[model samples]
Target: MSTSMAENATKKLTLKSGDDELFEVEETVALQSQTIKHMIDEQWLGDVIPLPNVTGKILSKVIEYCRRHAGAGAGSGDASTSKSEDELVLATTTSGDDLKAFDADFVKVDRCTLFDLILAAHYLNIRTLMDLTFQTAADMMKKLTVEEVRTMFNIENDFTKEEEEKIQQEHPSAFK
Candidate 1:
């Protein structure tokens, strides 16, 4: 093979989403994702693989998550250091509390963007993103009334006022 061709093969992979948006990521980093892993395993297509389900905006976020977690599996850094994650968990209330606070704060976003993140996370096979987004959704629901959920998700109220009353009468805790 030509030296120039070998150099090209060693270059970072470029991923294109369904919307024709692109992401250039190291092959090592891309392999951290199971979706990419499968494609690589099967020797599918070329260096520039396309993901129809993922959009550019969401794909970028997924890449960020994969990069953080790529080293995690290799026993690489803070995440895989000598101490178990739980070792410090019980020691410092403030440490754990700080992380919890960080998690909460990091998840602040509108419903639609949050959903888009979820979809991208799922497609990218990034567990942390999926878990965080799900937890964020649950937290949002916990803070809202039933009507608030309906309004937030833009769900139509199917029952008429009379039907609603009848159902409410049958199930006293319906709204709650």
Candidate 2:
């Protein structure tokens, strides 16, 4: 691609969050969101893309994830394709391991923030981000007992004592 054409292709997009904060992101990075890509393909280039369901904080995080994944050569090809041993090592260090570490840290947020991220990722049609956030939530639940899960999520237990006992009796392994 010519320099001018590449520059034009890399043009930045403005994303407006629910709080009315505007984020400038590269077209390639923003294209990671299927929703945004579809809107762009449909010729919706009128100023900023409004994300009415995403708060500024969660939107920022989502953009960060998109930017990282886009820049890391994700979906390009397998890292082992036509590369020397040293090149493969370097590629794994820079992309694979770093992205994994970033993902781990990214999900280390409060419950409210995590849920907001999940919702934003879903709304944006970012499958990878949605999966990461959902897996994090599932991991949290997996480590908690039923009572603990209810307490953490502020869920009211409507089951009567008799019903609860019956359930426990039927599923003794689950109660433990």
Candidate 3:
């Protein structure tokens, strides 16, 4: 690689969150989000790239996630691998236990923060972060009852008693 290319790869980009907090991150780290990469590619948006959908708190967490993953050598440029799913799994399991542990600890925040992370990950188009946050939420929901799940997400029950009974009767197995 050329010296200029290496310098460009390490160039820092300023990210401005919705709450107007600014963060400076490396080019490779910021490129983990396809949204930011698209913005940089289409137009160099001056000194700061604005992310209106993500708050400062959530944006910080997202930057932490990106930096850790990028430092672990994960990147969006490795789409040409010939390894199968099983092979990849085996490789990661054998060599990436520390990264796995880091991911586990990263998602151990409260439900509200987890949800915020999910929203930020989705809006930024960070696929791996989305998967991690989603899987964490799914794991939290497992073994919970319908009412418990609804309550956890602050969803209200809108069905009348008779409607609920009839639906349950029609799909008893689902209710179980």
Roughly what TM-score does model 1 have, to 2 decimal places? 0.67
Candidate order by decreasing lDDT? 2, 3, 1
Give per-residue CA lDDT, model 2, range 1-176, as digits (tens): 45655465457889999999999987767888999999999999589999899999889999888867765653356422333333344445566878899999999999999999999999999999989999999988888899999899899999999999999999987765
For candidate 2, give the lDDT.
0.82
- For residues 10-105, could you state the per-residue lDDT of candidate 1 as single tens digits? 447799998999898756567767788798799887868898998887788677655544433434354333222332232233344554565566
Cα lDDT, all candidates: 0.69, 0.82, 0.81
Q: Which pairs of residues have clashing backbones in candidate 3? A: none
- Per-candidate TM-score against the hidden true structure: 0.67, 0.84, 0.81
Say what the RMSD of model 3 is: 6.0
The number of clashing residue pairs in model 3 is 0
Off by over 4 Å in 3: 74-94, 170-176
- Which prediction has the highest TM-score against the true structure? 2
Report the C-alpha displacement of residue 137, candidate 3, in angstroms: 0.9
lDDT of 1 at 113: 77
For model 3, give the 10-residue run with minimal summed lDDT. Answer: 79-88
